[model samples]
Target: MMSFISRTVAACLCLVLLGCVAGQPERLAIDPRYDSVAPALQVYMERVRTGGERNAVLNWEEAGLAALELGDTDTARSAFDEALLRIESVFSDTEAAAKARSVWYAESIKDFKGEPYERAMAFFYRGLVDMWDGDYENARAMFKSGLQQDAFAEEQQNRSDFALHMFMIGWCCQMLGDYTAADEAYGQLREFRPDFATPSRDDNALVILETGGAPQKYAAGLEMSELRFRRGATQGVSRVDVRGLPAYPMEDIYWQASTRGGREVDRIVRGKAEFKVVQESVGKVMTQAGTAVMASGMRKDARKETKYVGAALTLIGISQMVMAANVDARVDARFWRNLPNRIHVVTTHVPCAATLPVVFRDGSGSVVQGGATTVRLLPAGNGFLGRATFLSSLLYGQ
Candidate 1:
């Protein structure tokens, strides 16, 4: 028969197992409205709002995308603001407990703290909204902020320079008549893609279309031997081929930066192999230490049933590990799905009534998806910009 202490220890172990399972964030349900968006977008947005506060960034991101689809620029801006605020809060917390919690439980809790690309997009999209509202001053400021993020990313070597953000910054600066800043922005872009073409000053109306979805996150696998845990990977839609009739082909830019400035600093690589190895090593030490404590307590019981106690505790530990693995493995998979995978800059003399027809295709050049929207080009001084008339249609695939 089990002694009081052994029975109590077993009960506690069971509770621990249960706690691991219970602590997992809830999976989000598909929002019906997501069906109305593009199929690729549907898959992306459908999963964004499901994780609750643990997924606050994703929630606001989805909200912003949905608002943009509906042409509600105000709501989209508000949602992006909230998303950025959540992201800022994560890095701004100086408390030891908060920091410890993040280190230990960030993945298991599903509290996504924004990837580099995602963070920059927050500023980029906000800038786009400002431009949509014809607020060039605020738009320029937002784009500059986004460029600063790119520079920071470059300095930290967290990610490659974001070509789209850089182009947008240059475009914004051009609109603001800051040709020097515009040249600087374009110059940086040229460093990435040397043969990239710039839109002529005489061109009117810039049509930017985001096709296909960003990479989806998925659980790679759990490695127990080396104490390595592979949590997330870029999955789902790989590459998209977009063609806008009567549009200029935009350049695809890619660049890398060094992490070591002058002296070497211990930097954290979030989702890479080295980072996962370190994370798992820490987790393994903690788990084993914890299991050892519980086992020791069980052995101290008067009952000679240490085998049974050990078995129970072992089961509990395994169960807890599995639960944590499952939870941690569940990736956020949320990103700015509405942003154009390809951008086309069309420069043509705008007639009183002109429409731009844009089409999206897969790698095989099959028209798997297409949008029906006719943008009216309005003359803005020397150049032309698309009126907000087609914003809803462009965004909603109408």
Candidate 2:
């Protein structure tokens, strides 16, 4: 009977090792035929095509950003829409979430919905796409949604402090001639970020400067159950000056990432870690005790009942050890890698047939070489909007 129980436990352990062990997902590979395409775009395009549903949100985000940068609004719109659809879906229904709650699965098993900041940026890009399409109402909605997503910051005081989205919402309202709504949005923006200048009705063009790189995420703590963020570097540009308006720092992506506090799943992972520790300690003690009992039972003076008891305890201890070893408490560290470190904004009118002058300055306010010098306004709805991204180190020499 003892031998039969031992075989059953061993078979179960084998099944777990063979079928339930978590494996890393396959990395996206670029085909050699697309060598002529820009490397970033090529990689993002490949990710969108091959990453499947588990990585769908992240893949689409990279693809959308790349396409948007290349002036492919149609593709960017579609990618952002797909990503938003998945992100806004019920969290409980996700495969990663379902599996992650179990002791045997890692949190990375879930689909990539991204951190709050990444999710908010999705709406920011989609809003821009809508703005370009003259859908001011939808654009306003997207900005508002982004604000809602940003409101989930871990610290209560930090929640809903994303002044960039607030400003965009106001800009969208102003474009639609809803001055009252615009006033409300601008009022909120002033409440949170007093330094930002409120745009006047005559201010028609908005310039957005996306500078620097994204925050980095990694797993730490016991069983790798804690999620942490490292601040991303901002290259050469520290201050920006546009010819006709105040270009001030509106959002810090790293601050948003770091302030997002803890997730509910974090507690769940920690609990699993504690359970594993307890099980391991108990199993070790029981195995040691069982071994001592079995050794005594092997003596000629020991009774048959003692031998049976020792075998049962040994089997139980082995089963507990197997279960403890199967526990997985790793945190999901998946993130949007292509996001900007900081976003600066300026709102003012641009004349027809005129270009807006932009100056990217380093820490000492000296103009950065090779940085964006001018931006041509794009006609949107009844007005013009100018947008440009200036990378400090990536695109210019300091």
Candidate 3:
């Protein structure tokens, strides 16, 4: 038999050879659907090499994830907050990052908002959170914001269906007063949805579709409605439609089908996409909207203001903006809907001259613009909330 020391030595050697230990990153093409953590971690690590608040952002995010995994809500919140601040620096230029980060920042808004999706997903019960947490209104509002990005697309329809996921979507819509659509969503489901996590992808394919505004339904349709250190005011919005198959519920794990039937089944090609809806909200005589840009040495920083601009809304709300159809999909593609540790900040002073570093698209769909006009790289609209708020504060002195 091998001696204790010999066994110990062998284990260590094995770990090193397998790239299991030694604090080294395991180079693997991660499947985001399985665990979104890897992508988040990789980005954090690369940014940390340069160091600063960016460093703090990564550390806090990791710690928060740990705390969350362990059920330590307090620690998780603190870490999340820290992460938010770190990534909050850019809101304008970094488009891709803000895409995903926006979900994080939305958690708190109108003083009553929470990152609709993130806050809901902080636990295994995202659907419940979306429905019960006094959030459905904001959820609807959040969806509205997503449309502003013009990221949704036609190919997104007929996404894989998960009974529970559709239930969650329908339920949120129900709470938000979209009973008709809610019912319609429910009608499409094959069974009643449960409220929890599961172990496998199995037969469930979940998907979400995003619409801007209140989506005025013909008898039926209608619609409605972020960021910063200043806190309270809602600005910039993005919608992400998570339509597709939701995984099998943990309770249903035993219900899976056996492959013994010899039935040939084609794997469904389900996907995620986003769109920028509406046009850029502009301001006018009686309204205040769009960013208020100012020159250097000016007492106040420039601010983007909006009234209620939708491409269709121009006849009414001048400042309301919407992303047009053409470039919307491309922009949504920038924010792959999955990045990590989104912190949002506003700029106290607009840079004299800002230039983004050379951007090579990462799978995340955002361009890493270094010099200026960027976001938490655009995970959320608030990715640049910090900068926007900072400039707003500097200029308006509010």
Question: In order, what lDDT does every prediction score?
Answer: 0.51, 0.81, 0.28
Candidate with more favorable, higher TM-score: 2 or 3: 2
Worst 10 residues of 1 by lDDT: 260-269
> How much does candidate 3 score in TM-score?
0.24
Span of ten consecutive residues with least summed lDDT in model 2? 389-398
For model 3 the local lDDT of residue 298 reads 32
lDDT of 2: 0.81
Clashing pairs in 2: 96-110
Distance (Å) between predicted and true CA of 111, model 2?
A: 2.1
Q: Write the per-residue lDDT of candidate 1 for residues 1-398, one digit (tens) a residue.
A: 56988999999999999997787556655445545654534544544555566666766676676666556666677768877777667443434324323423333343555455556667766776777666767776776666555554535543445666767777777777778888898898788657667756554455555443343333334321111212222122123322244443342211111221221111211333344555455556556665665576566563556555655655665655555453322233344434333344544445453555554444455444333445545443334455222123234321
CA lDDT of 284 in candidate 2? 82
Best by lDDT: 2
Q: Give candidate 3 regions above 4 Å deviation.
A: 1-65, 74-136, 139-167, 174-181, 187-398
Candidate 3 lDDT (Cα, 0 to 1): 0.28
Candidate 2 Cα deviation (angstroms), residue 361: 2.5
What's the true lDDT of residue 35 in model 1?
54
